[model samples]
Target: MRRTATGLLVVMAGLFGLARWMEPAYPAWSFVRAFAEAAMVGGMADWFAVTALFRHPLGIPIPHTAIIPNNKDRIAETLARFLRENFLTPIIVSRRMQRIDVAGAVGRFLADPVPGGRLRKGAGRLLADALEALDPERLGTMVRGGLVAQLRRLEVAPLIGQALAAAMTDGRHRPIIDTMILWADRTLDANQVLIRESVAKRAGSLLRWTGLDERLANAILDALHKLLAEMAADPDHPVRAKSEEGMAELAHRLQHDPELRAKVEHAKEEILDNPAISLWWQGVWEQARAGLLRAARSPDTAVAGFIGDGLRQLGDTLQREPRLAHTINRFARRATVGITTGYGDQIVRVVSETVRRWDTETLTGRLEQTVGRDLQYIRINGTLVGGLVGLLIHTFDTLI
Candidate 1:
C-alpha cells in the first residue's frame, strides 16, 4: 500500500516538474500542471484522512483523530449491545431453532451403523468409568436413603390387601385351592400305614387284640378319599363354597380391617428391620454393579446394543412421524429461547469484556492488516477523481 501511494506521488511530481520545464516551449503544459498539481493535493488529503482513523496524523493531537484507539470502549459496548439485541435475542434464537431439523439430523446420525457403534462404545466406557468411580459406602448410603424414603411413603398393608383382592378376583384362587387339596389327598393315601398305627394305638384293648384297627383305619381312609374326590369333582360342593367364602372374608378384612392392617404393617416393618434383608439388598447392588462393569467392558454388552438399536429405532420413527419431529422442534425451540433469554446479559458482557482486554497496539495492528489495503484503494480513487475535477476546472478557467 505504501509503495503504491509513493508511486502515484512520484508520478504526480514528475509530471509537474516536466510541465513546468515545458511550459515555455509548449502552451499545453498548463493543462498538465493543473491536473498533476491537483492530483498531488488530492492524494495527500486522502492519505491524511485514512491515517487519522487509526492515529493522529504526523503525531499531531487533533480533534476526533485516532478514532479507533480513542473510542475503543464505546465501540466495544455498541458492538456488544448490537449483537445481544439483534443476533442473540430470544426471538432470533427461537426462529433459528424452529428452522433447524434437530430430530431429523439426530435420526440420520443415529441410523448410521458406524457412528452408532462408536456412540455405544463411548457410552459403555463412560458408564464403566462412572461405576468404577463410585465409592461403595457412599453408594450404599445413597441407596439406603432412597429406599427409606420410598418405604416411608408406601402403605405396605393396603398395597398387599389390594394385591390379594386382585388375585382372588374371578375365581383365580380356586385353582390354587384345588392343587392344595389334591396334594393333601395324595398325602393321606400314601400315609395309610402311619394312620393305621395311630388308629391301633388309640383303639380299645379288644379292637387291638382282634386287629380290627386296620379295618377301622381302612374305613377312615376310604371316607377321606371319598370326601376329597367329591370336593374335586363337584364344583358346587359345600366345602368348596365355604373355603371361597372364607377367602372372600379374609380379602375384605385385609382391605378394610384396621386391626388386620396394623398387624400386617407391623410384620412388614419387622421384615424390613431384619439384618438379612439389608444384607440381601447390599448383595444385590454389589452383584448388579459387578455385572454392569463387566458388561460395560465387554463388547457383547446388552446396554450398549440396546442403546444403539434404540437410537436407530427412534431415528426411524422420527423420520416417519412428522408430528413427532414437530414436537421435538417445539421443545428444542423452547430450550434455545430459554437459554438465550436467561443468558443474554452474560453474552453481551462476554463480548465487551473480550474487547476490553485487547490492547490498542494489538487491536490497531489487526485492523490495519485486515483493511489497510482497501483504504489504500480509497486513496487512489480520491487522487484520480481530484485530478479529473481539477482538469475540468482548469479547462473551464482557460475557456472562460
Candidate 2:
C-alpha cells in the first residue's frame, strides 16, 4: 500500500515534468501541470503526516514527529487509565455481569455433550491436575489435624441441642421417633433367642418341663411387638408424648445444664483419645488417597463419567428450578463485581507495565500493522482530491 501510494506521487511528478516542458507549445498543458503540481503537494503532505506518526519525516529531527515512540510511556498510562475508568470499575463490571448469566452459561457448557466428550475430558484433566498437585500424605495429615482441632473447639452438646431444637420446631422429631420405633421392632426380632433364653432361666423347672416357659417367651415377644406397633401407629400415644417431653427436656439440658454438658464434653474427649479412632481415620485416609489416585490416573473414563453425570444433573436442576438458577446467577454477579472492585487497580497496573516494557520498534511495528493500511489510503485520497481541486482552480482562473 505504501509503495502504491508512493508510486502515484512519482507518476504525478513525471506528469508535471512532461506538462511543464510541453506548455511552451500548448496552453492546455498548463492545466495538466497545475493538477500534477497540486497532486504532488497533497501527496507529500499526507505522506509526511502518516510518517510523522511513526518516525521523523525524511529522517530529519522534526518537532511533533515520531509521536507514538516519543510518548510511549504517556500513551501506556493513558490507555491503562482509560481501561480502569471505563472498564474495570465496580459499576461497569456489575453492569456487564448483569447482562451475562454466568451460572446458566456454565450449566449449559457442562450439560452439552461435545464430540469425543471434550468438555468432560477437560474437566477430568483439570481435576486430575489439581489432585496431582496435592501430596496425599501431607493433605491427609493436615485434614486429620484440622478435624481434631475443630472437634476440640466444638461444643457438641450445644450443637446437638440446636439441631434438636430445629428438628422439633417443624415437627421433624416425629419421623425420628417413627424410625426409632421401627428399629426397636427389628431389634426384638433379632434378639428372640436371647429373650427365650432369659425366659427359660427365670422360669421354674416345672414350667420348663411342661413347655410353659416357651409360651411365656412368646407372650413377652408379642407384647413388646404390640407395644412398638402402638407407638408407631399412634402419634399421640402416652409413650410418644412422654418420649417427646423427655427429648424437649434433653434439648434444654444439653444447652443449659453445665453438668450434662461436661459429661458430653468428657465423652467427646474420650472418643478423641481412643487409639481405635486414630486407626480408623488412618485406614479411611489411606483408602481415600488410593481411590483418588486411581481415579486421577484414569479420570477421562472414571472421574469424568461421575463428574459429567453430576454436572448434567446440576444443569437439569438449574434448568428446572428458576429460583435456584437466579440465586446462582446473583452469587456469580456479586463475586465478579467483588473481583473487579478488589483487583481493578492491579489489573490496570499490569496493563500499563506491560505496555511500558515494550521497545519502540516493537510498539511501532504493532501499531503500524494495525492501522498503517488505512493511513496509506489517506495519502492516495489526498492526491486524487488535491488534483481535482487544482483542476477546478485552473478553470476558475481561466474564467476570470
> Best candidate per lDDT, number?
2
Candidate 1 lDDT tens digits, 1-400: 8679868977988998999899899989899989998998899899889989899999999998899999889988999999998989987898788779998987776666453376767877999999889897678769877996788667777776676678778667878789978998999978988999899999999998898887999999999999999999987899988987887788788879999988887887887788988888888888888877887787344534885578678878888899998999889889888889889899899989888889998778888899999999888887888788889999999999
Q: Lowest lDDT 10-mer window, candidate 1?
A: 299-308
Best candidate (score: TM-score) = 2
* Off by more than 4 A, model 2: 11-39, 117-134, 139-182, 197-213, 223-299, 387-400
lDDT score for residue 346 of model 2: 95
Q: TM-score of every model?
A: 0.53, 0.72
lDDT of 2 by residue, 83-145 (tens): 999999999988888888776776776566564565656666787677778887788879899
Whole-model lDDT for model 1 versus the true structure?
Answer: 0.84
lDDT of each: 0.84, 0.90
Ten contiguous residues with the weakest lDDT in model 2: 295-304
